[model samples]
Target chain A: MHPPRDGRGPADPPAERRVGLILFWLYVLLYGGFMALVLVRPDLLSVRPFGGVNLAIAYGMGLIASAFLLAVVYMVLRSGR
Target chain B: MLHETSATAVAIFAAFVLGVLWLSFFLGRKGQSASGYYAAHGQIHWFVNGIAFAGDYLSAASFLGICGMIAFTGYDGFLYSIGFLAGWIVALFVIAEPIKALGKFTFADALDARFQSRGIKLAVAISTLVVSIFYLIPQMVGAGSLIKPLLGLPHEVGVILVGVTVTLIVVTAGMVSTTWVQFIKGSLLVFFCGVLTILILGRGLAENTGSLAPQTLTVRPDGTRLVDGKPQERGHDLRPVGTIRALPERYGSRRETGALGPLAYLATLEDSRIVTWAAKKRVDAEGTHTVFTPTERSGADLLKPGGSFKGLTTGNLADRLDFASLMLALFCGTASLPHILIRYYTVKDGEAARRSTVVGIAAIGMFYVLTLYLGLGAMTSGALDPTDTNMAAPLLAKTFSNTLFAIISAIAFTTVLGTVSGLIMAGSGAVAHDLVENVLGIPMTDHEKVRCGKIAAVALGIVAMALGILFRNFNVSFLVGWAFNIAASANLPALVMLLFWPRTTKQGIIAAVTVGMVASLAWILLSADTFEKVYGLSREASVVPFSQPGLVTIPLGFFVLMVVSLLTARPAEHRA
Candidate 1:
């Protein structure tokens, strides 16, 4: 029933699709936790966890770092599979 | 504050614009076919496409706006950077490969692939147009703001200049030119910003012992202006503000902290005191009067959240919910954007799409990390243009050298150009490919399709210019936030369900897109912020509880899609 399409790749393999969704939810939880922390204990973010910068700066930068690392992980996992 | 309009800046900016236009013309002959026009023949290298993705994604809102926000208010601006980069995680894991597997020319192509429904095409096309225009407004506004300080031109002239140049780029070679322009611009932005960050780290934090006087601007009924109770004159203008008031006791009587490492810089700042600006406005029978007041805030307070956002510190439920909603929209919006979705098609395969996303994330993440330093540096540089937050980064560069300022400003202009062209490309595709050929059943050859798309691009350029000039006073990042909310609300639910759920009928997609778009739009138009800012009415008179609608509307989209899908489910399909 579907129309033929040009310049399209094969559908995502089922296993790869499953992995993608799993990773996707994992990220949602991580990001959601970040927002939740900001809402609940904003005072805690002001505390310097590592004796360097405060939790807010540390955690915010961590989020950016984590996204990039997770992306590299996904790419490696997909190719390894 | 006033600018002298440096000749070096004008020369550098003119050269950059000319280079981009020449590149567009040089690549003009290659993309005559619809595929090439829309997706650059699906032949771009993944690495190039990845950098181009960064170029396209980091608009004026990211560079000019976020830097300005952080320079003025602190970590609240970086929140936008974090939310923005976080959205790419969604794009990579959820939408990247699958979208490349489904769509041909536009986002509508991907959504309509299975159903072949004209209604789906029409609905998604309209959403694409709406989202693209919302996104375009900020880029154009940023363009106008950049032109004023850099070229000494009026705001309207700057908007038109960008509009005409971008339309020419799209009309000439479409995606071929667009992709290259983005790649070039993206490379330059990340590189120059990195250099600026290093310079900031080298210069370190310096305490200001100078006077922190406030500047007042009063507009008379006859259109005359006065600065500090004196008639507005070229030489007598508002003085620059924003500087460190004191360093920590560890530094003793030292006014400057020589040079510090990244973490040391931040820790030192956490222990320091800084001065920022607060603006107050009032209108009397004489005319409107504005005052730029300097307010001192602890570096610790500014480095943390809740300065500009105000929600975190207030502990009000509506404020918190508004902040949460904005974050959610930013997280979900990247995958839903039509311009970004089309970039997936510029690469050859699903794997390439995935690889390109990772590359984009790397480049974009690096730039964002550098933004923190750039903003914090500007905050204590004692050279901030308090009247305009959008000029913080450029002005920060000015403190170092005129040539550096010129280069930074020129790069920011191309940032606007790259983003605007990508947006216009998305809008034109929605009009020509989705609405005309797919929805209206207009039969057209490849040449005709390309011609139609070019016309649509020109039309969209004009509209964007008008909106830019109309909303000239609005902050660039604020407008972009609304675009994110709209994109997340209208596009995410349908795209996710279509790929994952077998029972998602065409009706569900159509209804979801329509309801989500309408609900978010209506919510925004009725929100307290819009009521006060756009309508010039009291904020308390607005109906919506909060400004951002994504927290409510994104879920509404999914809920509507589910109920409709179940109701319209075929018996055989339901059992499958």
Candidate 2:
């Protein structure tokens, strides 16, 4: 059978350990920030009685943050490789 | 139930299913080999795999459950969407490369890659099956739930239909067919939901003044009490029907009160109206069982977030911490789900796995955003079924047009199909690859392994059908939360530590998996929610302090792994 294309083998040291740690911390930061937003501005998470649920905007903010984190991780890992 | 079946909707659904099966069958020729059947020969294209990721990830819970929750509960439901999408970050950055580089078929393959210990394999494999089975229950339940309203058939029949169809698909084409089927379902689900959302926006909110007010019923000394002319008593709920009373204008601050036009209704909530229920006393020859009547809430009390978490706001720091812990479990749980992890194997390589995850996240994220609209729409449309939350979105479509309702219901059926196939595939793989091959020390060739897996697939399908029937009354999405808890607890610690922590020993991995799985399962069985919902017993009888097990089981897993690894440190050193 052909050797796996990715250079790292099963026995090789994990190449993305640092990246994984960075991502983990970034996740913690984003989660904390969102929770803080909810605590400080409960309105952001609340349903607007007349209009549509305003929480969509908050979820939108989350989506953007996740995308940004994903881009950064991709760049770091690709460059490292 | 009023409208006759639309040929176009039926045709669309049938064509969608058949088209997917055809593509899977055609491309699945390559999968005739053993590895191909199990893992697509690990050579799938990145883009195809990416779309397939959407197929595998967006299960019945995401489509029907989250939307239904949002329809009924407001922002709390959207939390599920956030948690689910957040998990991909873990998958992409932490798991994608390592998992692809390490394992061949099942998750156990990866966990036991460095340490070929039978103990590790046994622990991981059992965890895989447990998680997969728990996940399967919801999907099967969803299948039965959708079939009843969609085809107007019995629930058990729907479960059997899905079981047989999914089994045929898996046993014949395996992962290749399963992946394509998911891709099609994913694409259609996103497309239709987007279209539906646009339709909702275009129509806007409108006052249903012309429509008759929903009938309200009450229990009295005589028979059932009727407020107006219509049959008002809907199940165990009583009182006036509450709806979105008004909408906000140009800015979020300005509230417009009145009967909202169809489009404007999207933004309106009835400040003076609330939906609540009163307990009913049922008298029989044997005894009297309490019944309930759905009611509407009017006043300031309806404005607050209520339900299960009410105690948390007042309790000690631990109660507050428990809420955060539940959220954490949900966020991390998606990446750790066995059904999801197995999808990585369906693709060609690490790159494919990563790209697929990106696509899955995008599709899933967009759908979640639309769920806000769908839920809000249902809430105002007066289509809220107090009895069945799972039917919220489809019923919202029904209020708009019978044609839309038919189409949405068919798509919901496909959602069940897509998710159930993936769960069954994962379960079968665990049985064939991990339990039979690795744990049992079966001396079988690769071809023989594939054959055994197909048989296992059939067996799992049967079990799923039975469980689906047994758990028909439970909410499909609520059932899914238990699966997420078990998966996150049992799998995440071992998988993450093995990939990142060099000091992680074989024994540590095995112990962590065993402890995590058992702890979460036991905690769930003993929790208040299970007591009330599953056992039909009093919540006070529950031994567990909190209903959600993630707060306890997750940290417990990490703690067990660390302590065990330290004690077993000599194993690794001695090997070195």
Candidate 3:
């Protein structure tokens, strides 16, 4: 079986668990903010597709959003620690 | 952009290689024992290990390949960044602590911790080698590609140089020097890439994009020209001349008025139209080689999906599923990679592993963000080499200043050095620690094991060099996708099952790993993409139903493990 929740085995609250949770929210907020920007100015994500999907816009937005999300998680984990 | 090689580049390249060798030799003293050589005695500093994670993780595919892809294909390239980073979440949340808690030296140790079985050892060792070699190819290929432009050396020379240097590093200090070298390279790559991105954003975009001078075209053995009806070169004789035209852009009012800012570049492209490759033909000795050539596409045509997701535009379920499967492979593959998994062993504890991963994600994420800007910058820079997409970023740097070009090239070379060292170390560890010592029961002293590892390191280095030379023309990033697919299919199931599943027997682990590895390998070899790209055969002839095997092979591994464990459970208990 697993260890008790006093920072042992996989069951305990990791010192950084709160930090991870906070980071997740922070990422959502940041991404939300970016999405707001895109909504306000749709041009930011606009790119002329070169005969197909404009992967540039798709990926660029994806990265920004993902980075913000990752940062949120990282920050949450850090704060918890 | 100038084709001339710089004195600064040569000096930097030489110094970087020499510096690595110096560090290796200096650290060679401590790596005398097998544990010290393989895992740095599990005492590396957290910060250093974190950066080394960057080094081990960031291969030529990340540096040259991703940047080149972005420069050529735009956002499609940055998908790699997402896939790579997402995988780390799995590493951090799932694999990190448990792996550190379980084993040492190699990935096989963790899986075999609960049960001691020769079958498990052999299976994991084989999987490790297969993954390591698949991962090794792009590094070697990128090394060769970088050498051609940086030192003006042939592709084979670069491959041999990397082989020799990485072999020296692994043979001398094993993980210690490899970690340090990776740490240094990782730090410099991110720092320099950040600097480059700032420069790109600062410069923004410009109108009348300066066109790249045409690359020197090769004469086909069939006496045909790649361009119009030009005369073919007899023998190896050739002349450098500019021929290809830069595709013109329909300058919207914004671009016509003045240079574009970062946001304007993307905005204008969305509003205006750009020409990209569609399809073209070239005559060669084998026959006519049909390749995609970008043309001016607009409106709905430009909006449609191409390449891997060509059917996505039609909203077909199967096409969407294929796309999702590709992304799934990429996302999970990173954490499951053998080279990456073994990196956790370099640190002192689970905390270090976690912390280092954070640093890696930060550095790697920042660099990837910069890649989008750099890629967009190169796309419009008009400095892109039509023939050599790999040179996009460095060539873009050359447009601004020759010194930046030199530094970027040198750093790119170091990029190859850092990743190749990690792969060799992983490969060598499999041979020495996993196969020979653990599986074969080769009784030897620690020092002897270290010696054997170094010998294996040299051999693997040679093999990487040969493959690098052979697969010089294939896209480094594309080849990396195959690596990830194999890694995810073969390694992920075995790792996750071993860690989470209680009934997972040693026999089950072996069967899953063996079946997963073989199934994935066979699928890739027989896939339509492989048939067309590597074997130069008709796609219709391929037996594999899908180009990617992860969706099938991964689940198959889990099934095998479940069935095998249930069948063998009582038999094993009776035997005991």
Candidate 4:
């Protein structure tokens, strides 16, 4: 059973805490990269990178895919025994 | 635009609204205690809570607003989709577990848990109320706009109807009924949108080679409308526009490509030519003269980032900064929102909170992916109403069948209900739990607390209705942008520093919340967009360098918190 509720907030286990921060910064970098690309080299987004789809579509879809995958990974790593 | 009210639409809409009200009454007996009224006794199942997350997050702005933007502006709308989904990463990896462990009812509960200070409680509670009201305006305004076409009612009636119904939902059962309504709404939205995407893929794209003459609509001072040099009788008098002009040579003289895969659909569109429209308005002795001019462009350019976001490819510095600031706000806003924060208390434990967020991300991400196909399909459906872009998704369904259109419109209406109920629940909790009981130090029993919460819900509902009517003409999506920026600026820095920095003083948090809220609000009111749209003055007279304040104000929040903490910090031995 969980402990009684109180004013001071409870802390997560150390291993879980470390793992969460690592994954959190990893995603920050990925999203930051997308923004940087848009701001610095807006013209390059027009290039057809793959499957006759431009880099803009490919990159935008890739960011969405990455978010889901990273979330599933976090859940798997942090699941209870 | 004239929308002929269909009897079938009114029937389906009435059935949906009645069904939701019945569910609230059925659950009324379950919420008699403070915990039950606030967080459903923290006994809600993880899966239900997860989809309820989608229901709360995917507002009318996400469905009708994003789809319409994409249908009209191409890739710029999808940019919003990407930025929105990315914020869930911060929620899952950082906020989900800690917030679940911290709060009881309101977001203020979490922030004040460690401090137990009245100032902290007061500032956070006010921020919660302000953010909730700003967010509520867009949802209420969207409800008003949608009812005009679906029920043939005036905009004010729709706003009042939604306000009354949502208040009843909260006053009766609180979070129990709100969560269930969201679960039902979320399920139907994803399922129906999937069906629509499959239908779109099956039909594919076709070229229309008819005359490309544009139409002109002039509104006289006395409220008469003239279309194409003749008095407008019905909406159909102005013919539907938007079509593919030419296909790639790979099809070898074939005009339509029947039944396409998702990637193939995008690739095929990239190689074709599409017809897009541009609108111009002029005023003279008659009235306002509006013309929709059609122009053909290579699909390659249309699939990029410059259709609605001008100066993106042209290397204009001011426009790029505005785009970047908006994206930054969206990235950080999801975890900071008061309604989203309060949802953590509905589940049992930290583990449940984390798991439910994953489920939310999955459902929400899938819906966003399907939005691309739905918007692109609407772009080439040749049935767009050029005047009102918010009607794009429903009108696309109309091209298929009237029954489908009716069902989709009803689902969109429920979308408004679910989101507004969540916002009102957040606002009422802040008033009764945070302000009255905590800040003012008023003693109350469990029964008294529940009654106080119910009364607050009614007051907020009335306020929302009044603001919705007053701001009916303002763009719904533009107002939503203000909510996200303020939420991120005011709430995020305080929450992050409190969890991470042990030396954080109570004074620092109070400063951070106050500075972030005031600075962002001040910047928005002084922005160029506000100068032209709200103040009716020239854009050049504005003082702010850019419109979005996140790239500047969010960091300012962190800086203020750090400086205040250092100035007021205790010695190392005196800490804790």
Q: Give the count of colliding residue pairs in each prediction.
A: 0, 35, 19, 0
Q: Find the 10 residues in a row with the least total lDDT in model 1 chain B.
A: B496-505
Please give the CA lDDT of all the candidate structures.
0.92, 0.70, 0.71, 0.87
Q: Candidate 1 residues B174-283, lDDT tens each?
A: 99999999999999999999999999989889899778887888989998888988987788888888889999989998888987889999999999989998988888
Model 2: per-residue Cα lDDT over B1-576, one tens digit each:
122346665676566567656776677676677788888877777677777777777777887787777666654566666777777777876777678778888888887877778898888878888887888888888877776666667789888988887888888888888877877778888898887887776655543322223433333445444333333434423222225443333324343243344324333443334343333344454333444354444322332332323433354554555556667777778878877887777776666676666666667777777876787667556665554567778878877787788778777877777788888888888888888888899988878988998999899999999999988867676778888888889999988887656677788988899999999999989988789878978889999887778878888888899889978988656464
Q: Write the per-residue lDDT of candidate 4 for residues A1-81, one digit (tens) a residue.
A: 122235346457656677878888998998888788778877788898788788988898888888889888888988743
Every candidate's DockQ is 0.54, 0.23, 0.13, 0.51
Please state the i-RMS of candidate 2: 6.8
TM-scores of the candidates are: 0.98, 0.85, 0.85, 0.96
What docking grade does candidate 2 earn? acceptable
Better of 1 and 2 by lDDT: 1
Give the TM-score comparing model 3 with the true structure, all chains together.
0.85
Off by over 4 Å in 4: A1-7, B235-237, B283-285, B573-576
Which regions in candidate 1 have their CA more than 4 angstroms from the true location?
A1-10
> Highest lDDT among the candidates is held by which one?
1
